[model samples]
Target: MSAAYRFSVSIMPRDGILDPQGRAVEAALPELGAVNVHHVRVGRRVDLEVEAGTEAEAWTTVDRLAKELFANPLIESWQIESQPVTARMGPPK
Candidate 1:
């Protein structure tokens, strides 16, 4: 049986880019009584459970997927983290 791995990807807009969502949240913070909230930026995280033969294979597959489907290199960047699954949770619900 193939081994299962968990991958987490973080994608964020590059610096100096306009972040409308972040701006909206930042503006609302003052009203919510949040103190000293500055330079707020918004980003997305994606998690995946994949089956692969080995850790190296899993990393390679995830990296390729990230480049092709996850991040827009022109305006965004991505970070990837991965680990082998020792126990089965029977997929995410």
Candidate 2:
């Protein structure tokens, strides 16, 4: 049986890139009784799962998704990685 593979893609702007939304969130953290957090920038995350015959193909698909779907393609760099999966046997009925 072909195993199931999972991929997680995290998209974020490079350092020194301006993020108004992230700054807003950081500023508001104090209002929630949370402090001591600094230099916080926000990004997006996309989770995808597929059963592929090969690991190479799984990586390729994720790259395409990062370029065409998740990232802006102009001002963002993305990181995509495959997670290891080990099957756990359930109780036999």
Candidate 3:
């Protein structure tokens, strides 16, 4: 049986890249009493599930998916974090 793995993809703009949304949020932080917040870069996390026989397989699947759909390699970068999903079976009813 294949195991289900949950993977999280974090997408962020590359260093020295211009992030207009991040800039806008940073500009508003001071007015909201978050003066200490600096260089606030905004990013996104996407969670996905894959069924595979091994961790390598799951990672490979997620890597391809992330590059194809989650991140734009030209201006942004992505990282994948994953864990196995545990399902507890109760006594047969």
Candidate 4:
């Protein structure tokens, strides 16, 4: 039987790569009264649900998607965190 799983995918630019968004945020922070902050990097989180017979199967599915579609393998790296869903929640109103 397939069970519902929740996955949180985090995508970020690899270290040493130029992250313009991160640089922009870092520049703005000091002007906004924040100090001593450095090396700020911007990344994204994607929450998704999958149904599969086992945790491995669900991981494989999301892993493939993250590699092939979600992240740019050249400049970005990705991580996945998964957990079994005890109960499903309805969409936000």
Better of 1 and 3 by TM-score: 3
lDDT of 1 by residue, 1-93 (tens): 677788888988889988898999998998989967899889888788777888789889988888889888788888998744543345544
What are the per-residue Cα lDDT tens digits for candidate 2 across 1-93? Answer: 554567788988777789887899998999988898888878998877666778887788889978998999677889987776543233322
TM-score of 1: 0.85
Candidates sorted on TM-score, descending: 4, 3, 1, 2
What root-mean-square deviation over C-alphas does model 3 reach? Answer: 4.5
Off by over 4 Å in 4: 84-93
How many backbone overlaps does candidate 2 show?
A: 0
lDDT of candidate 1 at residue 37, scale 0 to 100: 85
How far does residue 34 in candidate 3 sit from its true spot (Å)?
1.0
* Per-candidate local distance difference test: 0.82, 0.79, 0.84, 0.86
In candidate 3, which residue ranges exceed 4 Å CA deviation? 84-93
Q: Spell out the clash pairs found in candidate 4.
A: none
State the RMSD for candidate 4: 2.5
Q: Candidate 4 at 52: error in angstroms?
A: 0.3
Best by lDDT: 4
On lDDT, who's better, 2 or 4? 4
Whose TM-score is greatest here?
4
Model 1 is weakest, by summed lDDT over 10 consecutive residues, at 84-93
lDDT of 1: 0.82
